[model samples]
Target: MRVEIDGISKSYVDSAGAPLHVVGGLTASIEQGEFVCIIGPSGCGKSTLLGMLGGLLPPDAGTIRFSGDRTATGEMTSIVWQDYALIPWRSIIDNVAFGLEVRGVGKQERKAIAQGYLETMGIGAFANAQPKQLSGGMRQRAGIARALASDPEVLLMDEPFAAVDAQTRTLLQEELLTVWENHRKTVIFITHGIEEALLLADRVLVLSGRPTKVVEDLKVPFARPRTADIAQTPEFGELKQHLWERLRDATRAAEWAEVEGANS
Candidate 1:
């Protein structure tokens, strides 16, 4: 579903009881079935924005409009968080079916449906295994499977692959792309990796430091079924360099501001 974020803003009170702005008048449009990645310096409220989009948190100001009334917070959107958030005590299959269970789906039906997603994620064999028994990458696959089981109109992923190792991260990226191609789900992915953004996103939205707003909204022109070799292309390298510089500069500026605040 298409999502339009209009004049959205948020802030929180710091330890010193001063209001600290996180996002400011951030507006963007994500078309139906579009894969959009938001990149910015650390602590710039990227995750916070994702939370608002998912309807887990409300914006302090402004509105999030979804075409056809599919607000991000409803069943139209599901989020796969960085921590996986799977139940350690439950079997993988049960965890994957948890949402269905909450929706009052029959046991047989939920398990059957959950298994379908597990097989899709290539984790069917681990269906009965406890989460702790699986490797980090495998656990993340299970997490994605669980999200897919919910069959959301849009997937809001907050650093979903950030916990995995490099090789595993690349593999997950490829697998995710394959799934996206097949299902064509609207995706809003938040990340710190410039190359990761370029490799997976149809468009990349760059944000500045705290009180963050979009600094750049770049469309990636690379052909789909993207592979590792795509990263080696000169055009890919140039875009990556440009995004890196933007993020680096924002980070440095935030650091200087923090130092000055401390001295004052």
Candidate 2:
């Protein structure tokens, strides 16, 4: 599915009742089946944008539209949160089947569908385990399996691998790519790691500080079926440096803006 975000803005009031603008007329278009990664300085409202895209939050202004075939009868979009929002009381397989259940899928059918995704994520063996019994990475795998089982047209991920160990994060990235290759879901991933963005995305959208907007949209040049070894390449290093410079500048500008606002 192709997503068009135009002039979308959102704001909230601070404790002092002062208005805090988080997204300011942010506009960007994501093409069908495109893996787009969003990155920005802290407080840039990346998650807020994702929330609006998923219909969890409303934009104060502007529109978000979807143009494409509705292949799935279930929800149009599913989100994989950073914390792996799973039910502690449910078994891993049950957790994965939750979305399907919510959609009114029959018990045996939902379990079958959920099992397929669990096997795809390489965690089928943990089907009966509770969320608390699994490691951070394992829980995240279950979370992703649950999202995929719903067969959403678009997947919104908010730093889904951020809580896992470095080695586990690398493994999960590769696993996600493999699944994405087969399923071709339109993905909008938000992350603070520039390298993670480069590694996973077909294009990276870099946002400005608070009241954020897309400041830069960069295409990743590496061929698909990517691995962590690509990070050793010179092109990857150069692109990483470029993103670092841009992110540093945005962070500094935000800091200055905060100082000015405090004084004013």
Candidate 3:
């Protein structure tokens, strides 16, 4: 395993001095190269949990470990953002190589590394293009390339396709699977889209309400290389319905919490 969250919890004091818990004793294990998706209601602190996994935020209790890779803290993660987080002034190749450059990788070597990633993403044609020059999907590919270029043991993605159009989103989904198939990099992807989660994940983690914790961890038994056609299958429908039912409970719980908090 590359990632483990052992009874992890996060809590903070509200402005009024009341205790606020974001995550509650959540636990999960992710094998190296496995793609896992965390899904839950809007305010359930799924993002907060992801932040913990990346070592960007410290949990108030329990632990998140990147086994054998780092001591005391997880050091396996590299994050990809929804907005594609590329510099506007940087060329496509430059943006992809940014991490390597930061690590003091020489120009010739970093450019070669960037070129390989761009070709893999099928965006080599746009190497000289700036961020503004590419389409939304292309820019996202650049971001993925940037993440992959770092060669991290784990990849964390936050709604990476949400910024693109539906068509582009579909294409990215296909491209993402291709990347995963080829590289087998351990990926912890977070998404609000249930279908996207089901399509990409080996396992789907459903979280409940505020003080979010794992409500369900459903395995996806479907075969890989998922296309839009796969979405039309009966098995896909069954999986989708199952996920919806799980999330429905979480949504209701979140709403009730809001109502109760207001009443109090």
Ranked candidates, highest lDDT first: 2, 1, 3
Per-residue alpha-carbon lDDT of candidate 1 for residues 1-264, written as tens digits (9 for 90 to 100): 899998899999999999999999999999999999999989999999988998988999988988845556557788898988999999999999999999999999999999999999999999999999999999999999999999998899999999999999999999999999999999999998999999999999999888888988999999998987799889999999999998888888878877887798
Candidate 3 residues lying further than 4 Å off, grouped into runs, are 13-17, 68-75
**TM-score for each candidate, following the candidate numbering:** 0.96, 0.97, 0.94
The per-residue C-alpha lDDT of model 1 at residue 204 equals 97
RMSD of each: 1.3, 1.9, 1.7
Deviating ranges (above 4 Å) for candidate 1: 68-70, 260-264
Candidate lDDT scores, in order, read 0.92, 0.93, 0.88
lDDT-wise, the better of 2 and 3 is 2
Instruction: Estimate, for each residue in 89-150, the C-alpha lDDT of model 3 and write its tens digit.
Output: 99999999999998899999999999999999999999999999899999999999999998
Clashes of each: 0, 0, 0
Best by lDDT: 2
lDDT of 2 by residue, 19-134 (tens): 99999999998999999999999988999999999988989998888883322223999999999999989999999999989889999999999999999999999999999899
